[model samples]
Target: MALAFDEYGRPFIILKEQERKSRLRGLDAQKANIAAGRAVARILRTSLGPKGMDKMLQSPDGDVIISTFSFFLSFSLANDGATILEQMDVDNQIAKLMVELSRSQDYEIGDGTTGVVVMAGSLLEQAEKLLERGIHPLRVAEGYEVASRIAFDHLEKISQKFEFGPDNIEPLVQTCMTTLSSKIVNRCKRALAEIAVKAVLAVADLERKDVNLDLIKVEGKVGGKLEDTELIYGIAVDKDMSHPQMPKRIEDAKIAILTCPFEPPKPKTKHKVDIDTVEKFQTLREQERKYFDDMVQKCKDVGATLVICQWGFDDEANHLLMHRNLPAVRWVGGVELELIAIATGGRIVPRFQELSPEKLGKAGIVREKSFGTTKDRMLYIEQCANSRAVTIFIRGGNKMMIEETKRSLHDALCVARNLIRNNSIVYGGGSAEISCSVAVEAAADRHPGVEQYAIRSFAEALDAIPLALAENSGLPPIDTLTAVKAQQIKENNPFCGIDCNDVGTNDMKEQNVFETLIGKQQQILLATQVVKMILKIDDVISPSEY
Candidate 1:
């Protein structure tokens, strides 16, 4: 703050976010905040629908990434909302709120990251007009809260129940395909959607209707074609035998999951050892050999055919284990080790004394598969004792394709899991938004206050989604939305949406476009919450950098 005097020599203070010259207050502050938020929202607006463009994001370190994306916020071929926000290097506080807005949608819903931001941005744009007309920001925020509730309730009213069972999974596959259609791997959406549905079902508990996504692993590799992607009923570790001479395959393997290294334990604190005398050196070497022998003996005495260690193997101990005819894989990560344990129904043996037959994990067959001319080998443990833990091993010609496929599959998998949890769904391609817009607009007449203006603006903001969808799909935005809106009214159909794919119909239900009910509700609620908070911030203050 800096002191200033009026013409009457009265003193007052000026508050600025940065330098003294950049003073902001009241309407100006709200406008600045709204603009900041809209800037972030505008970045994601183009990436809204299935025909949305991908963003190519490049980092300062020269890494190019095109990831899970949409709403046209391409950082690097990415249309995913959460990815673009997380990768964005924005300094604006309100813009950062937009990032958080995207993150909340991703965290709860796992999809529609781009759509959420676009929705929030449109809300802010509408609020800006209300503020310009002298409507209070608080009144605008309250109006939005009401509009959001109306939209949310209308979503539930229009949402349809999707049926699926172990024997009936086609509906789930169709829903997942809708998510994948907007992704970079749309051509293979059918196959990927089937794989995603199967993977979710394999890990999902039908009785509880809850899926522990941790039980499912999505492992990607740069090889073969995208069609080569398949679901494994067991764990697949990107590792091979410690030694080439070791057996490459084992049948009916009794596996040992170990945390301890092959070498003798070292002191936790710093220490030194002296071996000036040859006899002392020989004694020390003998002691080390004895330790290695005991560790190997403990593993073998327990009837373990395969060893997967959390730590790397010692060269001497590795040679000893190979010679002793025990196949071992070393340097496994902790999470992967746990997944392996879950997959094989094995206990992790942290010490040699813990080695027992009951502690072992059983697998029908464990084999090493090599890919590419580079001899990149991965260990495949198939037909496990516990068939619940599975992996979707993805193969693609390039890393970017694999990464994008991973994003696409992730969206599909989340949609499948969501359906299992709450089978209620709404039609996609902006059908839900259009329906909500109509509902909220109809409800606006019920209120007789200045907030009605803001409420009407909220209704208009809801149209931004269908507008973005139609615009991205190369259709005349206003004309297409107007036509669809007319159809929805004439037919009394809530499922009429933009024909983004030009599938010859504006009816998303007939087109089989699906989105989770809870997910759509979440998008509107989160966007409104963020926009309201942004509007309430009529001032931005930061410590002056020295």
Candidate 2:
């Protein structure tokens, strides 16, 4: 230890063992941070576009996730940007930032998670060159901010409004198909996209153009092929009747949604109850049976044909319920209960006193549907009074496929929702990026300062996306991008992008590949912001984490 004096002349003690700590400042710090972030972005780069690769990550628990993600969820097939980053266990703070960048994009835009991280990594790579050329890091960041604005504005100019209504849903379905094309479920992208779009529209309010995703439950079962996936007009739950002898179908049913328990309420605190004689025991048993009977009688009194309970009951109560002609489904999850209430326009009763005829939910038909075996059965609630709540019942060969399909459909659903909120759209296949790159590069000449160089670098970074797409698709990255850029300028057509699928034309419009305008703009703005943050970090200190 050593003593030191501050500016005020006060003495202080200093401890040794500084060897465990490390610090990087200025150029060294910036380079290290850039390298960490760039490494992460590079991992997701190949996962971009339709031909992009999927990442298969294994968790510590040995659960393998394969995502073409584009890995918020660990499935068998995926390489999605967000999914990969979320599953990747990283120590570097900058790398974690890149992960957050992807997550935020997924949360907000629901698509382009990989592309944003890839773009950020490209920008960082370019900024590293600028730093070596003696340009100020902040100056490079400022240039990026300027370039991002230009790209954002350019996206708006190139975007077109897509009109769709109840009578016209093909456009929305096509937009969602573009999203699913790069997913593991792309084999059935058309069917999945239709299901996604219809599910969104069912839960959406066209007048307000707003949708509450909660109302649309995504239900999946591992059994049939992906083609068996269907959208239900009502809620479908993985539950069956509480009893075997209970009728499987209830027509024009009156459902009593209950949160209260079926058995008599137990004491909250510890208590002693000793039976000294057989008569006392008999009286106590009779009292308990009375409680169960009263609860059942209350439902019958309220004219409830079906009872859906949030909590489970004992076999005694189940037997009594079945004998009393009340078909009760016990242990229904809270979410399914709320959906049931909404679908049937019923109220959830917490107490027997609150039970009334008006509180009962009305449904045209409630049936127990069995799949391959009677053991594999689900309760299908349909033709409700409200009927606004819906479910996308997905079936797959295995658990992994079902999980991967959920993530893919999630993106598709979000895309359809975004369009409903705002009908503006842009072409995909990296065409939009190429268009913005040409615009940003041309605008760079208008700047007179060193920011001009940074601006031009930003334009070059923009080419990384189309390049990556072309490369992943087995085409020459530079050649494909060059031809597309040339075509955009020659034909004055901004819709030209990398034809990853080798579909005759390079025009995304002709390919019918559509992406939301807000999503693309958000991607550019987010990538630039993250890169700028990384460039401005001139100091990184790691304290001994013991």
TM of each candidate vs. truth: 0.92, 0.95
lDDT of 2 by residue, 452-514 (tens): 999999999999999999999999888888999999999999999988999989999999999
In model 2, what is the error at residue 16, expressed in angstroms? Answer: 7.5
List candidate 1 stretches off by more than 4 Å: 1-21, 56-58, 61-77, 267-287
**Native RMSD of candidate 1 (Å):** 3.6
All predictions: root-mean-square deviation over Cα? 3.6, 2.4
lDDT of each residue in 230-306, candidate 1, tens digit only: 99999999999998889999999999999877678889999999779999999999998998888888888889999
Supply candidate 1's per-residue lDDT for 414: 87
Q: Model 1, residue 376: displacement in angstroms?
A: 1.2
The lDDT, on a scale of 0 to 1, for candidate 1 is 0.87
Instruction: Give the C-alpha miss distance for residue 531 in model 2, angstroms.
Output: 0.7
